[model samples]
Structures are given as C-alpha cells and as structure tokens.
Target: MICLYIGTNTGSCGLITAQKDPVPLKSVEVELEVRDHVATVVSTLNYENKEDKPLEAVFVLPLPGDAAVCHFSAQIGQTQIVAEVKEKQKAREEYDDALSSGQQVCLLTESDESPDIFSLCVGSLPPGESASIRLEYVTELAVQADDGLRFCLPAVLNPRYQPQGSAGAGFQVTSVPASLEPYSLSFSARVSSPRPVSKVESNCSLDPLQYLNTDQTQATVKLAAGHKFDRDVELLIYYKDAHQPTAVVEAGQASAEPGSLMGDPVVMVSLYPEFPQSVMSSTASCGEFVFLMDRSGSMGFRIKRRSLQTCIHSAKDTLLLLLKSLPMGCYFNIYSFGSRYEHIFPKSVEYSRQTMEEALKKVKKMKADLGETEILEPLKHIYSQPCILNQPRQLFVLTRGWVKNDKEVIDLVKKNSSSHRCFSFGTGENTSYIFINKISKEGGGHAQFITATDKIQPKVMQSLQFALQPSVIDISVTWDLPKEVSVTVLTPPITSILQGQRSLIYAQLTGQSSEAAEGCVTLKYSLAGHPSENQLHFSLRPAEDTGLTVHMLAARTLIRSLEMEARDNKGERDEEMKKVVEELSIQSGVSSAFTAFIAVSKSSGEAIQGPLIPPPSDFWHISAALLGQAQNYHDIHVCNFLITATESELSVKDPLLQLVSLLEASGCWLLKPALASVLGKTSKEVANLKPASASSEVWATILALIWLHGFKMDAKDEWELLAMKAASWLRAHNATCVTECVEAGNALLGCRVTKDALGL
Candidate 1:
C-alpha cells in the first residue's frame, strides 16, 4: 500500500508505503499547455523496476498557469489507485509573466486545495532521489498611449506552485529609448518564466512632440517596469518639420532670424549663481561714496570682544580701498550719527591717496556712545552741509532697524532725490524692509540687508556698482506684426546696453498674421547722452503652440531676483514681495518658499534650535510660519526661533557658527548701544526663567548670552563685565567653541578686535 501527505503552504511533500524491494524512479516530468485561454499540466514518473513490490513514489510538479490539473496513480501490491488534484499554476504564471513584461501583474494565492481538480497520489520507491523539475519563460513589453506614451513589461512565474503574495518575483521595464519617428518610442522585455497565455499588442504611439524642446532639437522619454521581468531596449526616431533648427546657437547667428526673435535672446552671462566679479569691480568705481554710520547706545553690543569696533574697522578698510580706486575729482565724507549727527572728517574730502588713509584712521578711532538711534538727523544734517549741497553723492547708511522717526528720514531722502542716493544696510534679522525700501526708492538707490557680517564687503561692493551705473536710460523696441496684433516687452531696467554683452528682452505677440509672416524689431537705448539700438525679427505661423521660449528664460531671471530679495528681507513681510514670490514659484515649478512652508508647517510649532545640531522637523515649521507672518513684531519672534534653532542644530565645533558670529558682529555695529543694553537685561531675565538640568533650554541661554555680550562697551562698565561672564560660560560649556566666537564677543564689547583676530 502507498500513502501520500503534503504540506502545501510549507512546500513539503512526501510519500509513504509498505514495500519489500521497490526500485526508485530516476526522473519526474510535468508539461503545461494552454489553448483558448484554458490550461492543463500533466505529471509523469518513470521507474526502472516494474515488479509488483508495493512501491511508494512521490513526484513534484511545476506550476505555470492560473488553473491546472494534477493526475496521479498509486501501485500497491498489483493494485492501482488514481486521483486528481486541482492547481492554480496557469493563472499565477500569467499574472507573474505580465508583470515582468512591464504590464500590470496581479496574483492571488490560496492555501487550501478544496476543489478536487488536482490529484494526490503516492507510490513506493526503493532507490536514489531524482532532481526537481522547474519551468521558465520570457516576458514581453506592453505599450499604451492616449495623451502620452507609456511602456510596460510583464513578469513570469511557474504555475504548479503558487508563490506567496510577498514573494520576490515580478517584472520590471528595463529601458525605453526615444523613437526616430516624430510620434513615440517602443518597449521590449525579457521574461524569467514561461507562461501558456501571453500576448503582445502592437501599433501603440506615444506623442513625441510633448517631450520635444521648444526649438525641437531634443526630446525626453521615460521607461517603467510592468510585472515580473526587466529588459533594456533602444529608441527609434522619426523627424518632422525639417525647417526647424537642429542645434542651439548664438542669438546673432542663424538662430537669431526674424522668427527666432519672438523669443528672448539666450545669453551666457553667468556661470555661477553669483553676479559677476568684473561687474562688481567696474560698477564700484562709477560714483563717489559718503559713509553714514550709527554710533548710538545700541551700537555698544560686543562682537569678538569689541562692540561695533570690528565693523568700524571693516568699513574703514572697504572705504580705504574704494577711495584709492575712485577716479580723479571723486569726493567722499565720513559721518557718524547717534541722537545727534557729526562728521568724523570734513563734510567732503576730495579723493586722494593720503586723505583716504587719514579718513580711515579717523573712522577706526571713533567710538559708540549712549544715545537713541536718530537715523534721519544725520541725513538732514548731511543735506544741509555746504560741501555736499550741490554735488551728487551716494549715501551708504549702516544701522540697526531701531531708528526713531524713520518716516522723517524717508521723506528727507525723497525730497533730495536729484542730488543723493541712499543705500541702507542693516545687520540683524530685525532690519526693517519698509524703511530700507522707502529710502532706497526715494534716493534712487537699492537697499542691502546683511545678516552675515563677513559678507558685508562683497554686498556693499555690489550695491555700489548698481548705484554707479547710469540711473536714467531708455529702451525702445519696434517689431513687425500683423494688423491689430498685440505685443508686450519685459526686461530689467537697463542703464545702458554694453557692447559685446547681450541685452535680454521679452515680448509676447498675438493676433493672426499671414501664415509664416516675418517682421523686424528694433531696440534703441539712450544712456548718459549716448544712444544705441539693435534689431531682431521673427517669422510667425498659426499653430496650436508657438516655439517661443524667451518668456521662460525671462521668468527665470525674475524669479532669481525675487528669491534673493526674499532671503535679504529675512524678517519682514511685504505684500508686493509675496505676490512676486508666488508668481515666480508658479512659473518655475520650483518654489523654495513653498518648500520652506511645508518644512515649517510639518513641525507643529516646535522651537527649532540649531548651530551645532539639527533640530527636529517641527522647529523648521514654526520658524517658517513665523517668518511668513505679516506683522514685524511677529516676525521678530521668527528670527528668535531661527537663532535658537541654529544653536540647537550646531555644535560649538561646527564651522557654520563662525558665520553666526560674524552676523552677531554686524548686529553690534547696526544696533544702538542703548537698545543693546535693554536687550541684555531682557535676555538675562529670560535665562533666569529657564529651569536647571534642561539641555533643551541651552539655545535660549546662548541667545541671552549673545544679547548681553552684544551691548558691552570696551570700557570697564557693567555690560563689559556681563559680556566677559557670557564668553566664559560659552567656552566652558561648548567644546566646539573657537577663537572666532571670542573675537566676535570682543567686537561686540567695543574692543579693537583686528581682522587678524577674526581670521578674515
């Protein structure tokens, strides 16, 4: 007698019987065939000995299709018993194969064999075991397209034994290449296992025009996996519209024809993210400069052991260089402001080698005093000065955004527009955009917000370049268009179009012209009593879409400007700015503002602390949310969050702390000594409120320490004493603390911290 037992889920099957001398089978074979969507599998076992010895034999079959049948017979002492076993190999194989071929593959396996479609049989075998049989097949790629092209591959697997749903078996699309034809690319695949029912659909077309560049020189294609298998393939190509150019060329070449002029000229102006160094250098020498610095009580904040002293030194160094570089006859003056305004040097010192050095020395010797930030008083006083009364001068105002009567200062700047231009620089996150923008607009200049002290030199140089360039210039464009056709031009204000440099111009045209109509556009610019013009033309055709990409490039430039502006005004809110940012985000599809918002919103109001550490995600949310708030007061809280978050994120060893220290130094220069004194008290109170053993509160303590240290004077005053205490605490607690922080602390303390001490 022969008996068989199988553990289906565990894949363990065995045979048992009562036999004396039964010969073993050498091999077991299973074959599966599918016709008209129906499949069947047959198993056969061959044994060497056929004597009636009650032999027990066991056979394993491979599954290929979704449904299958297993038939077997048992021989027991000259008696034969036959039975059937239902299998799901065919269905499973088809699903797996489809997936491998990059087609959608789905499989559902069941543990119980309830229906009697499969067979269970056993026979006695006496000899050696036979090798197990396995099945394999290849998968094909499936392509689909309606609006766009999609390539898919299917996966293949054996049917006799259904795999677990999570089993690592499936198809993947290996490659999709661009097609030579103008329409679409085709997909090909390879399969791992053979399935009875497999199908490949042809004549699928993907829209190639959708992926083509505006100039039709290049196209992009995407490939994806289907079910179970993966294979790589090449793309086919077909060209359409032979008139289209095959490559990108300079604007003055064949690419700049009348039809191409509809788009803005693409110029390789910058290789990096920053403005050109040459532009900064050349622009810095165009005009004269007058330095207006604040020396109020709030300016007593110590940075690197000197309160505002390092900033003064830095400014003096920049001025010395500027004076040396200025053209003959250019003039400047040094003015310091507190509750009152006073000229450190004469009202207007003619630019010369010796006078520049003398002025720099005088700037270095100046000191901060206890007084309110009366910003407008200095401007009014300068306007009244006889030496500057008639001369055109650029006023460089450096201060913290804590001025009383800011509106008066703005009005005075507006009243003196023809004779003066004001470039305002603020050191901390507390810089008021409202005041900066107002002064800049009224004085016909630009505002610069410097959060990092070290970056101030470069930023000031850039601003000076813009100021030196001609302010009043005109640009005129004349283009040929169909009658009633409309057009619009977009570009940055140009003081003058430089020779050998590309000037960008954006224009949009509408209304029907004759098919393939051509016209010319002339651009004339007037600058400093000189005039120049350039002409470009375009050929127009009526189509669902035109091949103009100039707007895209122009939009990118605008977006770049807006992003810089947003970062500069880090702690302020302006509706006009918000609108610009949103527009840029929509146009570019890359929104730093939106990403920042998402990052912050996810934090759920957690205080993000940074510097030597990375804060939790929630801290980012609160910081972004507070930064975006409309009120300045609320935004100040956001700056606090950022400062705290930085401390938490960075260790004393982090190099980024050096940047923070520089910013702290600049803040000392901008803030009045009196305000610094008050902030110190507030910071101390906040530190005292925190409980002991709270490592989380360390960021707050650090901020308080910085605030107190920032207001200390160089003399042996209470603030100086507090600053020393804070510096000692930082050095003791933060192992990564370096000499830079110590120097910054000293600078904030109004000490003569040198550039060498700052490692600048």
Candidate 2:
C-alpha cells in the first residue's frame, strides 16, 4: 500500500512518516523548463486511499529558497479544482469547512518563517478515491564561480529546532530507506539559451542529452528512472561564451485582463557589468577580517567520496589561506560556534607573525564537537564590539545553515549592517542558500558556496579580492523606452551592485509600441571614486507564449520586500498590509507568507468522514539515508562503503573492524580507514590474518556488535541472527571485550553507543 506519512507523529524535522495504516502517494514527477537564466518547474503528485475511511494528508517539503510558487491544481476522477490565493488563515478555514462538508479540498502555503519550506494539504479524500495534485514555481538560476548556471532540486528537508516562545515550527517527516517508500519519481528538463550550451553535469545519472537544434543551444534531458532520492538533485549548466549581457521580453498570459500585470508584456534584463581593470587592480590592503567557523556535528559530513577529510577540514584549510593572505596591519579575530561561541583572543588583534602562527595552531586542531549549530548569540557579541577607525570591519562567516530561527539571525545581521560588511560561506550536503543569500544581501556583501573541493580555494580567494577591492556605490538603473510606453518595475530598486556580478531586473510593459521598436537601459555606478555606466539595447518585440513566469516572479519579489518590511515591524501586522499582500498573491496566482492556495472539488457534494491525519512532503532532503545499495557494505572494501582509506592502513583489531561480520548480510559498512591502507597491498604484508585464533574470535564477536549498534537497520532479521550468535559467543568466550571494543569504535567514529542499547 502507498502510505501517506504526515503529521500523525512528527516533532518537526520534515521527514515522511510511516504509520500502521497510512494513505499512499504513488508517484512524483517534475517537468522543468529553462529560459535564459530562469527556470519554471511543475510537479505532480498522485495519491490513492485504499482504506475504508476518508483520508486527509499533509505533504511537507522543501523548495529552492528563492522559488516563487505560481500555480496549484488537483484532479480526482471527473472533478478538477484550480486553487485560488487567500489569507493563510482564511485559506485554512475554507479548507477545513470543505473537508468537514465531505468535499475534497487542498491547501498549499510557504512556511511563514523558513522560505525554503512549504506544505501542501489534501483533505477529505473519500474511501478508495484517488487524487492528483500539481504545483508550479519559478526561480532564477544562480551563477557559479565556474560560470555554470546552477539548479538544484532539494528532496531532503532536515529537522529544525524552534526556539522556546517562538511561533511553532512545522513538523518534518523522518527519512527511511528510499526503496521502502515505494514511491517512484520521473524528471525531465528542457534548456534554451542565447549562448551555445556546452554541457550538462550532475552527481545523479541522466539519460543522454538530445539537441533540438544544430547549434546545441536547445536541448532536452531526463533523469534515469532508477534514480534514488538520496541527495539534492543538482545540475550545472555551462555556456560556451561565459560572460555576456542579454535581455529577453516575454508575452503575457492570455487569460488575464489585457492591461493588468499578468496580461501585459514583461522583460527580464541580465547584466554582467565590466569594471576597468586598471582601477579594479588597486585593491586595499587594510581591513578587519573576522572569521567565524562552524564546529557543529554536521560539519563532519565528508564532501570527498573516499577521503577521510570532512567539510570542517576544508573550512579550516580555507581559514589558513585567508589568514596567511591578510595584510600585516589589518586586525583579525577567529570565532568558532556551535551551541555557544568562543574567540581566539579577548578582542580583535593585529595580524602579526606571532598571532598568525598561534591562530594556525588552533585552526589545525579544531574538531566538529559542538553540540548544535547555534550562531545567533555569538553574532550579537561580535556586533557589540566597536570597529577600528579608518579600518572597516569585514565579517567572514562559515556555517552549515542548521539554525532554526533564520529570521532572527537575519534581523541581527541587518541591524549590524552599518558597522560591518558581511561575507558568508555556507557548507553542507546542500548549502543553505536562503540564509547565506539573505545575510550577504542585507549586509552589503557577497555569498558563495564552499560545498565542493574544486571551487573552495578559488571562491574564497575571489571573495577576498572583492572584500579588499574598493566598494561600488551610487548604483542605479535607468531605462529609455518609446515615448508612449510606460514601464512598471517589478524588482526592488537597486541598492548594491558588484563588479563582475550578474544581476537580473524584471519589469512589465503597459503601453503598446511601434511594430519595429527597441528600448535601452543604463547601469550607473561609482567605482574607485569614479563614475561609470554600462548600457544595453534590445528589441521590444514580445516573445510568444511565455506563460506567467515573469509576472509571477515579479510578484514574488514584491512579496519578499513586503515580508522583509514586516520583519522589522513585528507585532504590527495591520489589515492594510494583509489586504495588499493577499490581493497581489491572488491576482498573480502565487502564494505568500500570509497567503495560501485553496481548492475544493465542486463536483463532489458530500465530505468524507474520518479522523484528521496529515503526513510529510512527497520528497525528502536526503542527507545520508540508506537507499539504493546494490551490494552488501560489509563484504566490500571498507574504503568503498564509507570513508576511503589511502594513507592509514587498517589493522584487524581496529575497533571498526568488528563491523565486518556484523553487516556482511545487511548493507551499512565495509570497515575503517585502517582497512583501506592495506586494501591494495599483498595479503602477506597485512597483519593478523589467520584461520581462527582466540583473539580473532573475541575481536570478531565484539566488532560485529559494534556495527549492529552504530549502523543497524530495523529489518534484516538474518543479520540479527548473526548478531545473536556473536553475543552468545562473546558471553561464553570473551564478554569483557564487548565494552572495550564498543568504546574504541565509538571513539574512532565520533559516535555514542550505550551498553544497554548494545544489549550488553
């Protein structure tokens, strides 16, 4: 049975639930269309209720942090409902009323606090009835350091801990083995660009690309059907000509009023402004560089497939490079935070040979031992300190983006913007794009991802260069259009613009123009105390059948501005603001913080009666869930299962070795780093390999127990049989080694295993 695992038992991590009797969602499919640098995605979910009673299911999931949801629709048999936007509470009330009245109702809303989170509620499905839901959203793609347009589909949403007395956080469904979920996924994408498409790359497998044109600028690709939902689906699209400015105009939606924003023509302008090389080369040598490092548990997540190194090591290495590169006279400080924070010195100190050496010593020895990812309190302390005169303060924050109160953190940064220019570096399986972007934007800085090894040093060095470069100021965009045409700007006014950075501006065309017409826009800014301008001209002809992407994207930008304003005016959620937001959301067919999409199956007259039960999102944010392993981990080379072993040769007594016999049948481990050291060497060169010795028996039994406790699965009763035999053998022969081996394994792996849990 397909199970709809939702809110029945979630404390709030955004994972799916599996109850005794649950509604089943059968299939998930996503279609993505890319134009220039923006992408619009449509997702469809199918659910069937086999139970005799009615079912109400909740699907909680994560979207791209910058996504703007524009459409929601549902179909059940002959009945189909298109959703309309309303105030969040009003939408909920309408959904509850429709559900209680025996009607099929659905509601979709973005998380009030976390922009990356969203929830879809499908209510009151009658027994044996099936429903199919579809949602569409648009987001602008981010340009990577390598000049690739990066697009990621987040299938995993980890749990967030809400602070006490704060607005309650949404619950997340826990993840399980992907194969056990029994849901299938299909994904397809189409690409169109002005520049020639070089290639498409991803960590996941994909079908061969098919080009519709000879130039290779237009193409389509699909994910291989057997793909597992184990990690963020990432796509890096490269263009032949890396840097160029372009403008695109799209036709309006036909169904809307001719003069309205939805129906009027729209234009999207992207510029990669060039700065004078002679002036940009004159970078400053004096500034205060404060480094905040993440020592949280998540930082231990390994980015390299086979290396023993984790993200923390890379972060530390980055810190070393940054510290060494700092100017001699500049002041610097290092603060590492998890639950609480600490500083390398009592206050900011000069970058001298002595201090640099001391800091390097501490940086090399730092470990990811902090309890949780708490960064707010440390930031407050940092902001409280005074900035040195004539030397501006530059904050370099490296974090895993695990904190729950993102709004609070954002507010703190905005408040401290005047004193410090913040540069953010995010690290994780999937970097926290929302938090890092907001932090950099509000603080007049730049945000970069340090997730991969290839871009780590270059991105850090580039950001450092930007930090040291004279700041660009007095930035503005001016448009010169046809005399009779009037333009309604959708994006907020330009505040901060950087050199070599690509930025997008969206606007609507209200009045008609001559058949053969063109318009121009100029970007004016002052750099290195000199005024500069860059201009572009493009035809005013509207591209046909562009859907409502640009208009909805415009609405989303407006909604975000309103939300940020509201953050500063907390407890002042007046009726006028609510009215304005609701109107915009409704007119654009988009969802906002205080707005949601609700629909009811009008053809169904009676509501189904049953207990109210909700579940999690259709997809997951797969951090490291066990799924799609073709071979038993225990039998494979230890390095292949988890950490790759190259430098350290593993010994048989290595506590992690106890894992070999333990999971030989089940999938979880191979052994340890020590094992990998001898992986390729001749057997004679390795130690402790014999038929059966007294030490071997004890060590095998103990190591097997450690594996069961550290990485055991619920099913696989046969593995449990092996475990029982190991325990019996230990009890009869060497029970004393049990506790010792467990402690040794836990110490090496940085985990906690209790005696009781180990069945001692």
Best by lDDT: 2
Using Cα atoms with residue i matched to residue i, what is each candidate's TM-score against the true structure? 0.33, 0.77
lDDT of 2 by residue, 33-63 (tens): 9887889999999888777666667666678
What lDDT would each prediction earn against the true structure?
A: 0.36, 0.69
**Candidate 1 lDDT score at position 97:** 38
lDDT of model number 1: 0.36
Q: How would you encode candidate 1's per-residue C-alpha lDDT over 356-440 as one tens digit per residue?
A: 6567567656655525456765677778865444345788887654443444466578778767677776543323434554576
RMSD of each: 29.4, 16.7
